[model samples]
Target: MTIKPFQVQNMLRHYGQHLDQGRRMARYRMLLQRASPEDVVNLSQDGRRKQLVEKIAAEIMDSLMVSGSSNPVVLEIKEELEREFGFGMEFRYLPLEPELQILRKEGEELTEVVGEEKQTILQRFWRITLAKVNETML
Candidate 1:
């Protein structure tokens, strides 16, 4: 994703240190104000401050993710989100299925018998995955 230089700088101003250190107390105050009314007895305490702040951070990060913005600046913001509030995206690879593995092996053997370039199942899968990653990076 492409992002303007000024936009990146603006994001940097709001994320990282600004998120964890400066705006923390300000957000807490806002939360307190929104949670309780002037006429009602105020029950806001320091005990719930951490939880409230974390909830706010989670909501912000959720909005950012749902927006589908994946610029490098957004990645840097995600890093800060993870570091400061324990909220960010996670990528994981599940194991291949046994049936798929068998099919791949059979395909490799058939290609070898047909005088095509010989490659093990693992090697072919690696090449396919590498090509896909490179294609997406562009």
Candidate 2:
């Protein structure tokens, strides 16, 4: 089946939202770390902080399986999702738009440092595309 563009956009929005939530949770953890010893002890003792971190981590992981830029994991998930859903998928990783290049240089540099694994990149992109498609259809 063919996936639609709007579906992909929706999935991307969801993925971005979850990722932001995960980042916020991480920031909370950092803030807690910087809190006074008594505050840290109280928060740690409550167990909710630990639970929140775990929950957020799980959400991030789930979102990542569908949206992660990592080559291998994305490929694997794509393959699984496509098999389950029966659709052709594709993804394009164009460089950041020229206007945003300067702001995104560090991320671009990191992706470069990580290097592209061609087979894996293609596989993951396809899988992510499939996921976007599937999510949209639902």
Q: What TM-score fits each model?
A: 0.21, 0.29
Per-residue CA lDDT of candidate 2, range 1-138, in tens? Answer: 999999999998776656555655676799778988566443554376445544543443344543445755456655664465455343322232211010112323422212344444444544455454444331
Clashing pairs in 1: none
Q: Would you list the C-alpha lDDT of every candidate in the order shown?
A: 0.40, 0.47
Which stretches of model 2 miss by more than 4 angstroms? Answer: 37-138
Cα lDDT tens digits for candidate 1, 1-138:
989999998786456433343344565688788875655554466435544544544433333332435754435544543454332333211132111111112323421111232134324433333333333432
Residue 28 of model 1 has an lDDT of 62
